[model samples]
Target: MVLPRSSSLKAFLVGAGLCGALLAQSAAQAAESSVWQDVQKAGVLRCGAAVAAPYVMRDAKTGDYSGYFVDLCRDFGEKVLKVKVSFVDTNWDNLVAGLQSNKWDLAMALNQTPERALAVAFTVPATDYQVSLLVNKDNPKLAEVKDDISALDKPDLTFAVMSGTAQDKAISSVIHSGKIMRLPGMDEARLAVMSKRADVLVDASDTNHLFALANPGWTREILPKPALAKQGVSFGVRRDISPADLEVLNIYLRQKRDTGDIQQLVDKASIEANAAK
Candidate 1:
């Protein structure tokens, strides 16, 4: 009922060869899991961007992207990864989605929050910022809200916030008495308060300062207390990225922080803001 010994030997060799092939395929698949390696192989780093001044910006004349965060990404490409850089523009609400969808390799200037951490991984903090408020200068009611940020939380008061942003969540947490106007962009949120369409804009302290510098007629207030949170800003990568890749980003940030590279940027932003004043 059995084949000859030679035929049996041939069958055994075939099964061993099949096992080796399967093992090789499994190893190859494992190697592909390291996203950093893939980036290296591609020789390009795609950065996801949602413009916010001092972080990301474009020159009107030259039409080039130049900001602290943009420059930092370029440094990472040249010094850390040895890759070329390209940018993909997105809105504040969709930056994370772009990274998760593989449209880009890194998400720039993301504020690390628990809700966001659930969807993406963050590098070590690049900077710290406070959640604050900006109110119309012409409003006679400003004095009442001056002593207490939460005083603006009244039925008649309205808050403007960029939709789907952390600031929106922050405002809703504490200002339950006021109505919120969700806007599509940061500029719109600031304008809502500036034009008196809304009473105040819940935003970052630095952002409000920049707005005040640009429009001397407008006034801004730093929230004596944050509604829900303050944010530590960082670059984001997909949750599935390799630990090695994360380490590379962290190391670069640490170097910048230790050398006062970040402080220099803060100083420059301050100078520019003051000049606008």
Candidate 2:
């Protein structure tokens, strides 16, 4: 029905006010949403994770992202959260910086440590791994790893480590060895050792396990003692974010774990051993 000009003016003004208020609320929500929420809304979760074996990797045939950690991020962010997963090829050196600058909202996979806590808060340690020892398949002498990884420091023992990785941090404490080579990521570390350029490559236990399964021809041996270090996996979030924001994300993570969606992904990615079990 037609209204008086004065009434129409009032109605238009009221509608405009409501719209303004709604827009403001939306803006506030966008600001508050953890990277995960932003990902959900964007219809894609931009994740930063090492593009190496059994964590987050590209399939040689299909060129799709696939791995234990990769599957977790994709399934949760894509299937459960209903957001497509887009991964940023990353290594240890720049992943933290990427997050700080808002390059991506989260890391699909990472280990939690006290020092790292200063930069990012994890989502309650979803998985576990050991600092393992890898050696040449043909040579059996390097199979045994002593306690505390002391052998890594021997001048004759060439060891390769993923650059800027937690392994490098741990190794830094005692790397007086021949040549401590730095690789782009764990994958290259394995390659270095495989080609015999380096005597050893220390990576996560589960990562090693998965790597062996994926590449059946490569024979490897675990330290038999794991050498002792506490490393667990969790999702990464910005450090400066609100505690309330973290708690909210924790809620989603807990829900995902309880439903066994997490485990299912682990199995699918062929890294069930990496899961908490």
Candidate 3:
């Protein structure tokens, strides 16, 4: 019952062709499902947002989100990706870790700092801002040193910083003698100071402004402008993001910057921030 030589050869050729076809199909699918492709298939982008003042805020009662970064994220999703937007609540302390863990696709309101760059990739900066100090009005220790920014770096003073932020790094670098109370978010940092648990809280300009607005006469600005302390605020993504996707986001931010749309958004957020207080 042995097959003839020519028939055996013909069957072998058919099997080889089928195998080749299957391999080709698999390769095509793999190409189609690149990370960006998966994003497309999902039809939604997951953006990470933290309650950093004027940038992002959630209404406790209504569960509605507002602020500059929220609007930016929604605009990016709808205008660029043509996808539905979903926001995940995250805090600065865990923001980059969440991105690396695939919890979210983008981290909004991230400031580009040398330390953060080691862990995550940043998009084009949406804006430039400066950091300032927010201190409780009743703190007597700050009264004498209020005139000088560096004078507050005393061993007795305690600074409340949101964990894993540039503010934390700044205090750690400049004020080795002081104690730092690492909090979860800006609100906690402000509360720590107001309650006399900490001497001061360092935050970005608008955020400090928000604290002032919320707690009238309770807090005041000290060292309102730190020398050469400007920071670039940008969105962050995983370090291994596809180059094409990063470029797409960079181009979008550039367009927003050039057209003054981002500034307009900031202006609107400022107004809204004041009203919220």
The candidate that achieves the highest TM-score relative to the unseen native structure: 1
Give all candidates' CA lDDT scores: 0.80, 0.70, 0.82
Q: In candidate 3, what residue range of length 10 has the lowest lDDT sum?
A: 221-230
Q: What value does the lDDT take at residue 111 in candidate 3?
A: 86
Mind giving the per-residue lDDT tens digits that candidate 2 earns over 60-95?
A: 577667776776666567666787778887767888
lDDT of 3 by residue, 105-215 (tens): 889988888878999999989988777888877778877765466788788999898887777776677777788899877778877887898998888877787668777
Order the candidates by TM-score, highest first: 1, 3, 2
What are the runs in model 3 whose C-alpha is more than 4 Å off?
1-35, 214-218, 224-229
The local distance difference test score of model 2 is 0.70
Q: Lowest lDDT 10-mer window, candidate 1?
A: 268-277
By lDDT, the best candidate is 3
The segments of candidate 1 whose C-alpha lies over 4 angstroms from its true place after superposition are: 1-32, 60-63, 226-228, 269-277
Candidate 2 shows a clash count of 0
lDDT of 2 at 250: 74
